[model samples]
Target: MNRIEKRMQELQQRGEKALITYITAGLPDMEGTKKLIRAQEEAGVDVVELGIPFSDPVADGPVIQDASYRSILKGTTLRKVLAMVKELRAEGCEQPLIFMMYYNTVMSYGVQNFADACVEIGIDGLIIPDLPMEEQGELKEALAGREETVIIPLVSPVSGDRIPKLVGDAKGFVYCVSSMGVTGNGGQFHAHVAEYLKQVKAVSPIPVMMGFGIRTAADVLPVKDVIDGAIVGSHFIQLMEESGYDTEKAKEYIRTFKTELNA
Candidate 1:
C-alpha cells in the first residue's frame, strides 16, 4: 500500500477519521506553499490536496478561483508545482500528496510524462474532477504498470446510479461532492446527503471522503459516520488569505481546525 492507503488504514485502526485539506500551489509563492504543506503535516492533516492553478476551474468556487488566479499571476505552472513536490520529498515531507487539477493540465503535460513525473516525485494520487469515468482509460493506461499513484474518482449527489461504477475501481479514496454545486459551502447539501453517502460507502471498497461545502466540523457531523474523512478547500484558502498568506498563521488555524475535527 502507498502512503494514502496505509495512512487511511492506520487511521481506521486508531478509530479516527481522515482530515484532508487543500491549498493552491504557489498561492503566495513556491516557498510559502512548501512551508504551508510542511505546516499541514506538522498540524496532523492526513492528506494534502495540492491544487494546480488553472484558468478555468469549473469545480472551484470564488475563494479557490481567486487563489488560483493569484498563483497564476505569480507565474506558477504545472512544471513548477511538480518541481516543488520533488523538493518537498527531498526535504523528507511524508504527507500523502494528491494533485487536484483539471484534465487540460494533464493533457498539456502529456499523460505518460505526467504519470511518470508523479511516481518519480512520490505523489500518491490524482484527483481530476473534470475527467469522466468513461474517458479515464488513457491516463489509466499511462499509469498502467505504476500502481503507486492511483486516480481518485469524484461522485456527486446527483450521480445517483453512477456512484458504484464511479468508485468501483477507485484507489486511495472516493471523493463524494457533498452538494450539487461547486467547491464552497454557500449552499445546503442535497436533501438526502446522508443517504447518498451511505450508498457510496456501501459500494466503495476504499475510504469515502466528502468534499465541497465541508468547511468545518459541524458541516461534517451529519454524515461523519458514513465517511472516512472530509476535505476542506475554500475554508483553508480563506484562512491563509485572512492571515495574509502567512504560513505560520495558517498552520495555527489548521491545528485548531483539526482539534475540533478529532474531538
Candidate 2:
C-alpha cells in the first residue's frame, strides 16, 4: 500500500479520524509552501493536498482562486510542483502528499510522463476535479502497473445514481463534497448529509472524507460519525492570507483544528 492507504489504515486501527489539509503550491512562494507543509504535518495533519494552481479553477472559491492566481503569477507550473515534491521527499517529509489539480494540467504534462513523475517523486494520489469517471481511462491506463499511486474519486450529494460508478474502482479515499456550493463558502450542508455519506460509505471500499465548507470541528461534528476524515482547504488558505503567510500562525491553526478534530 502507498502512504495514503497505509495512513488511512493506521488511523482506522488507532480509532482516529484523519485530518487532511490543503495548501496552494507556491502560494507565498515555493519555499514558503514547503515550510507550511512541514508545519502542518508537525501540527498533526494526516494528509496534505497540494493544490496545483490552474488558470481557471472552476471548483475553487474566491480565497483559493486568489491564492491560485498569485501562485500562477509566481511562475508555479506542474513541473516546478513535481520538483518541489521530490525535494520534500528527499528532505524526509513523510506525510502522504496528494495533488489536487485540473485534468488539463495532466494532459499538458503528457499522461505517461506525469504518472512516471508522480511515481518517482513519491506522490501518493491525485484529485483531478475536471476528469470525470468516464474519461479517466487514459490516466488509469498510464498508472496501470503502478498500484502505489491512486486516483481518488469525488462524490457529491447530487451524485444520486453515479455514486457507485464513481467509487467502484476508487483508490485512496472518496472525497465527499459536503455541500452543493464551491469551496470556502462555509454554508450549511445539505439536509440529508448524514444519509448521503451513509450511502457513500456503504458502497465505498476505502475511507470516505468530507470537504467543502469545513472550517472547524463544529462543521465536522454533524457528520463526524459518518466520515473517515475532514478536508480543510479554503479556510487554510484564508488563515495563511490573514497571517501574511506566516508559518507559525498557520501551524497554530492546524494544531488547534487537529486538537478539536480528535476531541
Candidate 3:
C-alpha cells in the first residue's frame, strides 16, 4: 500500500482522525515549499496535498487563485514540483505526498507520462479537481501497473446519486467537499453538512475526508464522528501568507490546531 492508504489504516487502528494538509507546490518560492511540507509533517499532518500551480485554477477561490498565480509568475512548472518531491524523498521524507492539479495541466504534460513520473517519484495519489468521474478511464489505464499511485476521486455536497459511484472506486480517503463552492476559508457551512457527510460516509467503505471551508479545528469537531478526517487547504495557505511564509510558525500553529481538534 502507498503511504496514503497505510496512514489512513494506521489512523483507523488508533481510533484517531487523520490530518491532511494542502499547499501550492511553488508558493512563497520553490525551496520554501519543501520546508513547508516538512514542517506540516512534523506538526502532525498525516498527508500532504502538493498543489501543482496552474494558469487557470477554476475550482480555486480568490486566495488559492492568488497563490497559484504567484507561483506561476515564479515559473513553477509541473516538472519542478515533481523534482521537489524527488528531493524530499532523497532526504528521507516519507510523508504521503499527493498531487492536486487541474486536468488541463495533466493533458499538456501527457497523462501517462505524468502518472509514470508520480510512480517513479513515490507520489501516493493524484487529485485532479476538474477531472470528471466519466473521464477517469484513460487516467486509470495510465495508472494500471502502479497500484501505489492512485487517482483519488472527489465527492461534492451536491453529488446526488453520483456519490456512491465516486466513492466505490475511490483510492485514498474520499475528499468530500463540505460546501458547494470553490476552495476558500471561512465560508459558511450549512446545517445539512453533517447530513451530507453522513450520506458520503454511508457509501464510502474507505475513510471520508471533508474539505473546503474547513479552517479551524472547531470546524471539524462537529463532524469528527461522522467522517474519518478533515482536509485543510486555503486556510493553511492564508496562515502561511500571514506568517510571511515562515514555515516554522505555520507548524506551531498546526500543532495548536491539532490540540484543539483533539480536545
Candidate 4:
C-alpha cells in the first residue's frame, strides 16, 4: 500500500477519521506555498490536496476561484508544483500529498509524463474532478507504470446509480462531494448529505471522505460517523486571504483547525 492507503488503514485501526486540507499552490508565491504545506504536515493533516491553479475551474467556488486566479497570476504551474513536492519529499516530510486538478492540466503537461513526474516527486495520489468515470481508461493507461500513485474517485448527488462503479475504481479513499454546488460551506451543508454520504460509504471498499462545503470541525461531526474524513478548502483559503498571508496566522490556523478536527 502507498502512503494514502496505509494512512487511511492506520486511521481506521485507531478508530479515528482523517482531516484532509486543500490549498492552491503558489497562492501568494511558491515559497509561501511550501511553508504552508510544511505547516499543514506539522498540523497533523492526514492528506494535503495541493490544487494546481487552473484558469477555468468550474468545480471551485468563489473563494477558491479567487485564489486560483491569484496563484495563476503568480505563475503556478504543474511543473513548479511537482518540483516543490520533490523538495518537500527530499526534506523528509512524510505527510501524504495529492494533486487535485482538472484533467486539462494533466493532458497539457502530457499524461504519462505527469504521472511519472508525480511518482518521481513522491506525490501520493490525484483527484481529477473533471475526469468522468467513463473516461478514466486513458488516464489508467498513462498510469500503467506507476507503482503507488493513486487516483481517488469522486461522487456527487447527481451520480445516482454510478456510485458503486465509481468507488469501485478508486485506489485510495473516495472523495464524495457533499453538495450540488462548488466548494465552500455556503452557511450549511446540503439537507440530505449525510444519508447520501452513508450510501457512498456503504459501497466504497476504501474509506469515504466528504469534500465541498466542509469548512469547520463541526461540519465533520454530522458526517464523521458515516464517512471516513472531511476535506476543507475554501475555508482555509478564506482564512489565509483574510490574514493577508501572514505566515504565523496561516500556521496557527491550520494547527488549530487540525485540533478541531481531532477534537
Candidate 5:
C-alpha cells in the first residue's frame, strides 16, 4: 500500500480522525511552503494537501484564490511544485503529500506527463477538483502505471445519484466536500454533511475525508465518527498569512490545532 492508504488504515485502526492540512505551494514563497509542510508533519498531521496554483481556481474561495494568484505571480508552476516535493523528500520529510489542483493545469502539462512527474517526485496522491468522474478515464489510465500516485475523487452533497459511481472509482480516499458551495464560505457543518458522509462511507470502500469550512476542532468534533479525516485549509492559510510566514508561529498554530482535535 502507498503512504496514503497506510495512513488511512492506521487512523482507522486507532479510531481517530486524521488531520489533513492544505497550503498553496510557493505561497509566501517556496521556502515557506516547505516549512509549512514540515511543520504540519511535526504537528501530527496525517496528510498534507499542496495546492498547485492555477490562473482560475473555480471551486476555491477568496482566501485560496488570492493565495493561488500570489503563488503564480511568484513563479510557482507545476514543475516547480513537483521539484519542491523532490527536495522535501531529500530532506527526509515522509508525510504523505497530495497535490490539489484544477484540470486545466494538469491538461496543460498533459495527464500522463503530470502523473509521471508526480510519481518520480514521490507524491502520494492527486486531488483534481475540477476533473469530473466521467472525464477521468485518461488520467486514471495514466496514473495506473505509477505505483506512488493515487487519484482521489471529490464528492459533494449535490452529487446525488452519481455518488456511488464516483466512490467506486476513487482510490486513495473520497474527499467529501462539506458543502455544496465554494471552500471557506460554509460557516458550519450542515446536517446534510453528516448524512452525506454516512452515505458515502457506506458505499465507499476506501476512507472518506471531509474538507471546506472545517476550521476548528469544535467544527470537526461533532462529525468525527462519521468520516476518516478532516481537512482545514482557509483557517491554516489565514494563520500562515497572519504569522507573516513565521515558521515557528506556523508550527505552533498547527500544534495547537492538532492538540485541540485530539483533546
Candidate 6:
C-alpha cells in the first residue's frame, strides 16, 4: 500500500477520523510552502493534498482561486511542485502527499509521464477534479502499472447511479464533494450530506472522505460517524493568507481542527 492507503488504514484501525489539509504549492513561495507542509504534519494532519495551481480551477472558490492566481503569477508549475515534493522527501517527511490539480494541467504534462514522475517522487495519490470518471482509463492503467499511487475520484450528491461504478474502480479513498459548487467554507452543509455519505459508503469498498464545504471542526464533528475524514481547503488557505504565511499559526489552526474532530 502507498502512504495514502496506509494512513487511511491506520486511521480506521485506531477509530479516528482523518484530518486532510490542502494548500496551494508555491502560494507565497516555495520556502513557505515547505514550511506549511511540515507544520501540517506536525499539527496532526493525516494526509496533505498539495494543490497544483491551474489557470482554470473551476472546482475552487474565491480563496483557492486567488491562491492559484497568486501561485501562477509567482511562476509555479507542475515541475516546480514535483520538485518541492522531492525536497520534502529528501528532508524525510513521509506523511502522505497527494497532488490535487485540474485535468488540463496533467494533459499538458502528458499523463503517463506525469504518473511516472509522481511515482518516482513518492507522491501518494492524484486528485484531478475536472476529469470525468469515464475518461480515466489510460491514466489508471499507467499509474497502476507504475506504483500504488491512488487515483482518487470525486462524487457529488448529484452523481446518482454512477456512484457505484465510480467507487468500484477507485483506489485509495473516494473524495465526496459536500456541496454542489466550488471549494469554500461559506456554504452551509446540506441536510443531504449525511445521506450522501451513506449512499457513497454503501457502494465504496474503500474509505470515503468529504471535502468542498468543510471548513471548521463543528462542520465536521456531526458527520464523523458516517465518513472517514473531512478535507478543509479554503478556510485553511484563508487563514494562511491572513497570517502572512506564519507557519506556527497555520499549525495551530490545524491542531484546533484536529481537536474539534476528535472531540
Clashing residue pair totals per candidate (backbone < 3 A): 0, 0, 0, 0, 0, 0
Candidate 4 regions exceeding 4 Å error are none
Name the lDDT value of residue 175 in candidate 6: 94
Candidate 6 structure, TM-score to reference? 0.96
Q: Which candidate has the top score in lDDT?
A: 2
Which lDDT tens digits does candidate 5 get at residues 1-263?
Answer: 88998988887798777788889999789987888888778867889999999888999999999999999999999888888899999999999999999988888999889888888888998888878888988988987756688888898988878899998866788999998678896456656778888999999999888899877777877777788778889888887898787778766766777677767
Flag regions of model 3 displaced more than 4 Å.
none
State the C-alpha lDDT per candidate: 0.89, 0.91, 0.87, 0.84, 0.85, 0.87
Model 5: lowest-lDDT 10 consecutive positions: 185-194
List of clashing residue pairs for candidate 3 = none
Question: What TM-score would candidate 3 get against the native?
Answer: 0.97
Q: Candidate 2 at residue 14, lDDT?
A: 89
| lDDT score for candidate 1 against the true structure | 0.89
Error of 5 at 181 (Å): 1.4
- Give the poorly placed runs of model 1, Cα more than 4 Å off: none
Inter-residue clash pairs, candidate 2: none
Decide which is better by lDDT, 4 or 5.
Answer: 5
- The C-alpha stretches of model 6 lying farther than 4 A from their native spots are none
Tens-place lDDT per residue, model 4, 1-263, is: 88999999999898877888898999778988888888777767789899999999989989999899988988888888888888888999898999999999999999889888888888889988899878888878877866578888989977878999998867889988888878885546667887888788788899988888766778677666788888888887888878876767766766676677667
- Model 2 scores a TM of 0.97
Error of 1 at 29 (Å): 0.3
Which of the two, 1 or 4, has more lDDT?
Answer: 1
Give the Å shift of residue 42 in candidate 6. Answer: 1.5
Worst 10 residues of 1 by lDDT: 250-259
lDDT of 1 by residue, 103-174 (tens): 999999999899999999999999998999999999999888777899998999889888879988789999
